[model samples]
Target: MVVPAQGLPASVRIHEVGARDGLQNEKAVVPTEIKAEFIHRLAEAGLTTIEATSFVHPKWVPQLADAERLFPLLDDIEGVALPVLVPNERGLDRALALGADRIAVFASATESFAKANLNRTVDESLGMFAPVVARAKEQRVHVRGYLSMCFGDPWEGAVPVHQVVRVAKSLMDLGCDELSLGDTIGVATPAHVRSLLAALNEEGVPTSAIGVHFHDTYGQALANTLAALQHGVTTVDASAGGLGGCPYAKSATGNLATEDLVWMLQGLGIDTGVDLGRLTATSVWLAERLGRPSPSRTVRALSPDSHKE
Candidate 1:
């Protein structure tokens, strides 16, 4: 590991979304047993917060249609958080039926993205989530709110900082434990990230209550994560093996890979509680299942016989 960097959090809590967000956009429907094993491997690799699946309509996301079947198999796994996405009251109800303790609600910072993704306007979407968040909190289930397109949107060019702050605050006010600001299109630079964090702070949203989910379309994920860390944001979201892209965002690409994030955190001596070798091996294994190589550069570099020491 490299020496620790200054002005950074001593440790970061990586919310791994590979199983959910990563596989959601894949064209092939991964087998339910494979999904179960993937989640198991992730936990074995020290990923405590693994997003298992989304409880959306089968017509909307056919890949995760087995949420009901997949969730039950995770019951034997101990000491790990498997959060599933709940889009509405029904989704929440389904998750609760399966004894889900951690849930995530997703919304967009841009009106176009909201309408296209959720078929509702910004305010309407939040209104829809109000009761869902309330009921989840009522059930004592942990809720994470996702604010997509926080930096830029495909339909709307550059998103204003206030827009993101407004949506984020609304989610927080609705009882979300943490708001994950997503650069859904991967257009955010480090400066943009800093400005957004500064603006959110000015709006009285604590850095502690924020996490960042960046896409690597422009290869700025790590740089932007460093910016977020410097601004005192301790939670960061990453997908294992760079496995995800926003299905709703046409210009978007894969998410920041867990292996890449782990490499950087390990090099900086920042604790993420992930085992890099096992993570790399897992990603390689997953890539084989997906019938392609992982998009993560770190995984490629660290794979056996891929490079010289």
Candidate 2:
């Protein structure tokens, strides 16, 4: 559907990141069966675009070392887009071998973040993705590019808007079907989100091909997401139970909560197709597995015990 003149789309698509982005940084080693169950439950809660896992090296992200084992189990799940993160050509090879049709690659918008996360400079990281993107297209796999630290960086302070637009265009040129702009450090305000989206639009990046991923470091995730929605960002990334932070960026914190985002969107009369009560229950259940109370206010507010069912 076309974005209205106010720039908000009638419906929004949520990219659920709980399985991959959410769990990757968790200290506890979540078992393979549990991870698979998490993904299934997310789909059952009406999330169609759930990011399942990553193929990054075990030494780097031990939490997701079970990607190879996890992918096959999820192969039969229908209607949902189960995209996994592939850090390089090797990861892509593993994913393609398993007949994984959807994959995501991450690139940093700042040099310090690139070095810390991928051990490469920004240009070098893009160079690595060129071949990976090419190979994925050759294999008819869908590719989503993740541009991290788009709003600000820990070491570098505020990131220039132009830097994000440049990297975003490069990823699109390399054949990414969409780009998820990340506020890795979660320092972005609504104004910052608007300016960035405007810059990207000026550079000819269609709003339809862009998504926003925010963290609630300053409790601004939902507000920033609302700003993006007003600017026509249809796809927003959120994690169940508000579970995620960038391990490479210490200042980063929990992602925007899926239940919280759903609550806001549904109240705004935006269709997300998610069952709020079921999604909240899923987060509560997953939080139990993680041995902690969920960080999501919506989940806590809607939970049966907290408020009368």
Candidate 3:
């Protein structure tokens, strides 16, 4: 059933965000032990790049407050990149003190999201990230810049491709090793996705350095992903079991499920180094703990209960 696509890359690197982005928005705090176990399970399931947690102030995101405690338990995990999100210099310092070699900085592509998420304007947020990116690069740590609201903003409505390109170029200028373009509100169609990617390329942002993070709000995540793949984007950001959305953006919904993405990649004969069975099992186990079934269609279809009724 595997059909090789003509333009798609031979392999894609899935930037798993289930451990960090997935759990961060939870109303009920997932215990530190469970979070660590979840990460271990994800790693065991063959995800090489897993976002671990955020180092932002506890007051802002109380769910992931145990980042310091949760990060150490994962030290024993080898061969997987454990990247943490750092909001500012203090967050970066805390991550560095704990021996973190990979970190990500979040940026907003619109003024409204910048004010809501970071409490600063777009340019000011970039200024804040400048030092953090510089210091991380100085220490040879890998840095990823996440640009939110790339396709559309809840408050700003449809974002212009030029506006997104401006912010994206600023993030890359900050010495980031990679940039993840976020469709935060899930309002993007395939044509919009292609337009933005082409604009970024025109502005000198190479496809190799860009990753796509899509939300499934309008059910266009997979379609938009295919558009990116056609444009040669190889890194995709997905959450396990379709777990997370932007806590700040009320209209935002769960991210594109990793299980679903894996299924499509498997069908396309693209290698992602993921074992679908093990990953589904992991999501099922976590779902039981959370008292809800996974939102991922692939997970539900592949789970043991899929045969029931």
Q: In what order do the candidates fall by TM-score, top score first?
A: 3, 1, 2
User: Which wins on TM-score, candidate 2 or candidate 3?
Assistant: 3
Q: Residue-wise lDDT of candidate 1 within 1-309, one digit each (tens)?
A: 598888999999999999999999999999999999999999999998999999999999999999999999999999999999999999999999999999999999999999999999999999999999999999999999999999999988999999899999899999999999999999999999999999989988999999999999999999999999999999999999999998889899999999999999989989989999999888888888888888899998888553333
Backbone clashes in model 1, listed as residue pairs: none
* Residue 182, model 2, lDDT: 97
- Candidate 1 regions exceeding 4 Å error are 304-309
Among these predicted structures, which one has the highest lDDT? 3
For each candidate in turn, the TM-score is 0.98, 0.96, 0.98
lDDT of 2 by residue, 1-309 (tens): 223344567889999999999999999899999999889989998999999999999999999999889989997789999898999999999988888899999999999999999999999999999999999998889999999999999999999999899999999999999999999989999999999999988998999999999999999999999999988889999999899998999999999999999888877778889988889888888887887788899888887564333
Stretches off by above 4 angstroms in model 3 are 304-309
Per-residue lDDT over 49-89 for candidate 3, one digit per residue giving the tens place of the 0 to 100 score: 99999999999999999999999999899999999999999
- Alpha carbon lDDT of each predicted model: 0.94, 0.91, 0.96
Candidates 1 and 2 compared: the better one by lDDT is: 1
| Clash number for each model | 0, 0, 0
TM-score of 3: 0.98
